[model samples]
Target: MPKLPAELRGRGGPDALMAAVGRFSDLMTPLLGLTARGRRPAGPVDRSLQVVVTSVRAEADGVVSVRLADLAGRPLPGWQPGCHLDVHLPSGRVRQYSLCGDPRDRTAYRIAVRLIEDGGGGSREVHALAEGRRLTVSPPRNAFPLAVTARHVFVAGGIGITPILPMVQAAARRGADWHLLYLGRTAAALPFLDELAPHGDRVTVRTDDLGGPPSAALLPDVTGATVHACGPAPLIGLVRDAVRGRALSFHSERFTPAPVVGGRPFEVRLARQNVTVHVPAGRTALDAIRDAVPDVAYSCRQGFCGTCRVRVLGGEPDHRDNALTDDERRSEMMICVSRATGLDLTLDL
Candidate 1:
């Protein structure tokens, strides 16, 4: 038997390696079969890559930036300004972090995490990572893509600046008219201020400690510029309200899952566990299921990462996630952001 690399050994030893190989074989079965021709399969497939953390540095109060590179020193995949990586932690917890480093630098990818002491343990796990720590991450996925417009207005709040930083850099390189409104609860909590120094006056720094709180008046004139905002829901809402009835285009991404809009109460039956979970209006099925199944996996509850996808054995699904394709929607649904259209749904669990 050939020796497997350390990165491929995984925590489950040989058994895990064989299981992974089996999954890969299954994924390729259709492609190699004569009836399939050369067409690829529908829906997403796991193409996670192993990387070693080369550097970790504190970017601000309770925030740190980590740099990861391929274990074999090979160039990683190229990503756009708004792209993010689904990082799998050693504890089997998955989390999404925006790719903040320069796209031209393919040797390594940078991601920042802010400590959320009271929230899930993902950020805490990331903060504990040290140099040379190994991690598996999904290929870069972009939910918020920057448009190729002449003028751009960016609004960033706290850690939300991670994705906006790369967009601002891209806009400057293109010689497009751009300005950034970087807001934080306090100046000390903001990360990557040094990186934005080159942009000079084009960047606006406003902290709640210094200036009460951000309002529509603080927003720059977005008349002809495309507005890109990412931050707390309130900040994004302010920008959305400001841009309403205007001639400009608006895009925004949230750090948290969007509030359930027009949601109706529904019940989800876990077939394997023989249990049923009730999802109330304004609450996600993921949350309700976790009450019965504590170890359910999920990341980026915003519905773009596809980590919480479950097989729909019966009932109609009100698919609201962006990760799944039409083919996937037929049999599977993302339980994090998507819900049932009817009163009940049966899940594979």
Candidate 2:
């Protein structure tokens, strides 16, 4: 992989943060000509790379901290905060994980994976992975990005903190005024608290009584800063409603899929394969595909992962994958949650 340019570093006594900003800004200079978020490359493009596990730290019952080093005797892509990597597991399952380390180094990348009891083995396999394990990963891809507003307010719930970790670190490095309200079931379940304690005056930890709901009082008065969040659906709903149209800004990332609105049954016709399957209400296209064709496979059943992507030949598809843009939505498809607007949908399958 090509190392990041050296000019990004500030001259003389300037800091790495400014250097990174300058480096990234130059990469995005082409984007400045446009106002809308274009689909074009924002910076030097990142690619999928393989990594070797150097260490693993089990945080709690299911949470595991991971450190990845490049296996090709080179550094991983230098990714901005909030960038994620696709991990190819030994079980032949691929999952996306957020990079939680500083982006300045072309060196190793770090991430924390939480094992989900109900999930399909990816997290459990990752947690059990020992040192020397080889993991194939995508170069950093950032679906969630920071804004240049005056300040920032960060909200993280449980394992959702993985993606937000670097953002907080970046905020501190920029001397940007920011605060983090970390809401989890307990401190034992949270990681990196020791490192975050110094941000004490700025960082707040919230734990609710089992079976009770968590309050968002820690989200202090906000007028200028942008609020960024990532967590479970319930926490997001609560925080989203609380900050509805308030002076506080809001943004979030979800590992879990968004709730899909139930609708009437629809017909899915595999265009090339000539297989027509009726996707009934309460059933997704993937489910229908699996029942009729078990050869097809996917990692995240949720819309969050793009492993189940297919081509949309005709009809409007309700795109639910985090992998696509509005333009891509009109073209390709995520068979996992997407449905057909027309009675007959044509999919590449």
Candidate 3:
């Protein structure tokens, strides 16, 4: 419940906070280091802390945002726009959510969860939590980060807007040129329309019930601009194809697993465990590895989280994960999605 050092709160500017956090990163991880693609390795050190749920309220249809605070009225660790927290649910299901509240407000952290009826039960458990509930959570870890640019363009689909909201506000606070193209199934399904309305023409809301779907028209000329998008896989795919030949740089985050097209059943040879696990063609390598090991660490099995990363002593990996860098992929592989290009893969375990 103790407050982070005054230097961490930026009362003395960011340098002090960065240095302090970096020095104590093992206790509470630092948030600055990111790949060129705005990604961080998944297995951040064990730094979970306890916090109380101060409030819980509905944001939109099937979406609820919760506010968390330290029990002793102290400032929490500083986090930027695209960072997410690992929420350890009472049922022992760990889920990740983006921080949507003001980055300047270190006193409390806010995040929104969209209930997925068919999900792995994480959202359902979060929705059922009451006020004053205590929860274990990791310090903020950012896989998607906003680039410092003169002009920024944001595109968010459905519940994916949770991370982009803070980025928009950060841009506005810094007087950077920014615009948004927010899409949803219906107006009622959008969470922050009322808040975004005040931004005027800077924000555009498109719903399937009214405007059909967002087209290239909603996107401005991305020439020399940095684009940030988060949403369903299909929307991100469309954006990728639409901007294929443009000079713009695009960054995106998706909650869904990457399509493992044409992946064949492969064998994972656990060198340390001395066992051979067959990863079925349709199933993920993580599933097969977990079946054999039963205790391997993994989170966000969608390939974004690097928790399942292991050294590939042999075999050519298909490498479907979005988290690893080209250099990192040479030696390590995220077992959650990446599969063997050849018949068998030998893992260091």
RMSD of each: 10.6, 10.0, 9.9
Give the lDDT of residue 1 in candidate 3.
Answer: 22
Q: Candidates 1 and 2: which is better by TM-score? A: 1
lDDT per residue (tens digit) for residues 241-283 in model 2:
7777774467878877666676568898877668889988777
Better of 1 and 2 by lDDT: 1
The stretch of ten residues in a row with the least summed lDDT in candidate 3 is: 1-10
Mark the 10 consecutive residues where model 2 has the least summed lDDT: 1-10
- Across residues 27-92, which tens digit of lDDT does each residue of candidate 1 receive? 877666522345555665557899999999999999999999999999999999999999999999
lDDT of each: 0.91, 0.78, 0.85
Q: What is the lDDT of candidate 1?
A: 0.91
- Model 3 alpha-carbon drift over 4 Å, by segment: 1-46, 267-278, 287-297, 309-333, 341-349
User: In candidate 3, what are the lDDT values of residues 1-349, reduced to their tens digit?
Assistant: 2244455444653456556665665444335554434467567556677899999999899999899998777789999999999888887767788999998998899999889897667899889989999998889999999997998889999888999999998888899988888999998888977778878999988899998887877677777778898998889988777766673688999877766677799899999999999998888998888778876767688877677889999999999888999999999999988898889999998
lDDT sort, best first: 1, 3, 2
* TM-scores of the candidates in the order shown: 0.86, 0.76, 0.75
For candidate 2, give the lDDT of residue 156: 91
TM-score of 3: 0.75
